[model samples]
Target chain A: MSVKHALLALLEQEPMYGYQLRAEFEQRTGTTWPLNVGQVYTTLSRLERDGLAQGGGEDTEGHVIYRITDAGRDEVATWFTTPVARTQPPRDELAIKLALAVTVPGVDVATVIQQQRSATMAALQDYTRLKRQATGTARAELAWSLVLDSLVFAAEAEVRWLDHCEARLRRAAAELDVQNSRLTDGTSSVKREFRRSTGETHADRTRR
Target chain B: MTAVLQLTDVVRVHGEAPHEVQALRGVSFAAYAGELVAVMGPSGSGKSTLLTIAGGLDQPTSGAVTVEGVDLARLGQPERARMRRTSIGYVFQGFNLIPALTAAENVALPRELDGVAPRQARAEARQALEEVGIPHLADRFPDDMSGGQQQRVAIARAVVAERRLILADEPTGALDTETGEEILRLLRARCDAGAAGVLVTHEARHAAWADRVVFLRDGVVVDETGADRAETLTEPAAR
Candidate 1:
């Protein structure tokens, strides 16, 4: 999802200040991809370097603005011509945690979720301390603050989800185990098993 | 195998009266099953327009376009649209997702429209979303996703419809280097899944993604190259 064209896509309409661009981007997509002012400006510079855009000149506040060029418009049109299909969010740590939860016999899903919860909670604590301790007015420090905020929120969200997952996994353990055995052995016959439960012959089931 | 799409001297005109524009002119091309072809051209060269006609979403003003062994001009508009909904999966540039719908809902829409049960449709959507690696996002709306994430969700939606032919205008047009590469890889994976896809792009980088690339010039097919192809073509190399 780390596509610079996201910013470029917004720039296709008209020139905008970096701060304005960031705000518009967040508002338009509901902030699915959050960006700091620095990240926005850095991406703008790269786009300018790539000849996809040119600076639109600064306003009274010294904030530089940008607009998509003919080349950039061409790029945008090209961008629109193809269908974007991202099926998978890259490699998520959660995927690995869940995969092993079932494959490793006796490996407790609840325990794994708890382990992640505690680790993430600890990390969130450190982020909190670092965010509070920072007092400098440096631009870099302010930028770090935004990143830290994102990290803190994400860590907190994960811990919350892990707790919910632990409860669900525990409650479903017995039933999941029966299903799990059939799934693992690859012997769950859809027709035979369904007929056995319904007490109907295969021919009768097919007729119905 | 039947040619999935065959365009013979097709033309598409837009606008009327005081002004007129020809998006396509005497363009001819063919796509076979199991083929992944790239459509390449400069802006306004009409590659996207041509793809829409080939996919049966737009009608040609003159000449002929035969899709799925049926003459497109022969089919009624409603029938053509149904054919498109069932046979063609379009990956658009803007990711045109339904913001109000959950990721799974978006993926299951075509099926629901085709009258599949909501529960059954959702089950299929879940599988498709899982195939694309965002099954967890099934409950989230488009607003809650990243650009790459939204695109993945869109891809799952496109494929989940169970369409056999894909007409992608620029599957990676909006992403950075890494994300674009990921998109191209996924599109290629679609081809490996026994579905044929036609990709249109201005970048030569994606020329590798197609079994063939049909370069367009002034709305005409100029050159056709296979995968692993390199040619001077007297045109500047695509960046």
Candidate 2:
């Protein structure tokens, strides 16, 4: 996801104008992650400022081409070798919403979970459709297909998470109901034995 | 534009009233020729029941089930059996191939039961096997073939005789990921070749191969995705 590193890597291959860089990036990712021409130029300028690349020479069409420097080649090599840092995790809206849904009073958590599952399934279906359309024999097409597969995998994982959340919610609600009934029934031997042995009050049990 | 399989307000109930369990509650669905529709839901959400009802293997407690313009409820047992052998084909998670018969023989059984001559049936089965990309395995027994090969044979049998409606229950469930994908590709190819396919699956990735996805909850249709809607989902932004 590091655009600067991506641009440098493409430059490491060969000199490319802004338009060619954008096109190459989009082609490799199937345009699932479309690069703006301006953004490409901005990254190229930043790379030049950092002495990793030099913008010089002109292609046949009079477009300025960027070439990777020795520093840029080393940067690309390091990028490939280093594991991507995950210390700063990206914000996950779904996880945050689910957390609030569980804690917020009067929220319809089940409906929220179902809605997300449906949406994720729809996205997963679209990725699959795109994948089917991609013949993937060529190198660029195969790269695009891999990008689509990543999206499909992430969407499928989201759906499974939603299903897990729903099940846990249902189980928690059922357990609460059982505890409520036991509290109201003085003759319930399970509750009586638990109170006698652990001395855990109903409030403590509810919190647990 | 005609539907190969249609279920109109279908319902199925189990046991007597005191303990009756409603498996499908007025579920209506249709799969047209050249289309593959995926049915997805949690276990016991009536996905399997819907496939069974569509295939005419189980009777709906109410509502009409139609296949290729024929009302399944109106057919007698013998007539329905004939319909099963001719108009419909079923693929299951398990290959369900006859252990004793070779691949070709197993695929040819349905055609032969429909009264096609033995020679013609075997020929047709070979063609079906070819369509599934396993013509060379025609003489191999199920025990000798890999799981993927057995699944291919199962698909060949389902698609033999150019069955108009194909009902598959988790057809890729028993195979590895790559093998499962190959199986789905075969199913998609068959649907593209004018067979209407109904795939019941819990795996979203498997269901994604279908043209449309229908979700069930507690025996009721809860959500359905449209083809147009699939087009509207935005791609992830460039990082």
Q: Pick by lDDT: which candidate is best?
A: 2
Error of 2 at B53 (Å): 2.0
Model 2 over residues A1-208: C-alpha lDDT tens digits?
7999989998888899999999999999977778898999899899999999999999788999999999999999999999999999899999999999999999999999888887888889789989889975999898899888889889998888898898899989999999887778665787578787997777886899
Candidate No. with top DockQ: 2
TM-score of the A chain in model 2: 0.89
TM accuracy, model 2: 0.89
CA lDDT scores, all candidates in order: 0.75, 0.90
lDDT of 1: 0.75
Model 2 chain A poorest ten-residue lDDT run: A183-192
For candidate 2, give the lDDT: 0.90
Instruction: Write candidate 1's Cα lDDT for B80-152 as tens digits.
Output: 8777767778888789999889999998998888788999999999998988888788999999888888888
- Residue B202 error, candidate 2, Å: 0.7
